[model samples]
Target: MSTVKRWTVDVLVNDDEGRTYAEACLHSGEADTRLVGIGRAKLNPADRDIPEIGDELAAARALCDLGQRLLVEAANDIEAVTHEPVRLRR
Candidate 1:
């Protein structure tokens, strides 16, 4: 049997204390697995004032963190079921 599933990911950014913060949330909509990742980028006083750039950088960092979390969760799930060390396949 074959199956197809859709996952949703959302990234939100906010500015506070002269820094941009981003959070990435991923929902598989199955098994109640919801992953969240956070990132921040400080606004340098000497740097150009570009809000969009800060937002982009923070969002990218959050997504990268979220991806790492997903990978770790996958490894843990595999190990839990197989009772063996996980070797992630590419």
Candidate 2:
């Protein structure tokens, strides 16, 4: 029988839509500066072996980028709230 391994990762990601966004990021690297997970987003078992080559960047960059996006989004949201712009439906 095959064994399953699970890891615990703590990422300071914004309250995103849910795992959908995260999974999308995992699949496509075209994630915008939106809600993201930052810091120690994940914890891999010491015994587990991770591949060297990958479509994703290093964990450090990944987390930082996520964090940055979250910050940017927050700033923009705050601006919108302060400005209180009105929208018109076309």
Candidate 3:
């Protein structure tokens, strides 16, 4: 037998003044857990005014941080079951 699970990640991006901020939220139905990650991108003085680029960068960084947090959470769960320290790698 096999089991199938569903997970969802929502990313919201906002731009203010020359800076972009992103928040990534992860929802796991199986675990009933929620995790959030935040990221920001600042426009360099010499850079051009491209809002899309900043949004992309900020969202990517936020997702990356969310992934790391998920890994750590998984490691903690495993350690709890095994009674030993565990490290998870991407």
> Which residues of candidate 1, in runs, are more than 4 Å off?
87-90
Best by lDDT: 3
RMSD of 1: 1.8
Q: Where does candidate 2 stray beyond 4 Å?
A: 1-57, 84-90
Clashes of each: 0, 3, 0
TM-score of each: 0.89, 0.34, 0.93
The TM-score that candidate 3 achieves is: 0.93
lDDT of 3 by residue, 1-90 (tens): 999999999999999999999999999997789999888999998999999999999999999999999899999989999999997769
Model 2 earns a TM-score of 0.34
Q: Order of candidates by TM-score, top first?
A: 3, 1, 2
Runs of candidate 3 with Cα error greater than 4 angstroms are none
- Report the lDDT tens digits of candidate 2 across residue range 1-90: 995544333432322211111211222124332243533222244433333211132445555665566556666677788886443322
Residues 2-64 of candidate 1 have per-residue lDDT tens digits of 998889899999987669999999999776789998888988999987988889989999999
- Write down the TM-score for model 1: 0.89
Query: Per-residue lDDT for 28 in model 2?
Result: 19
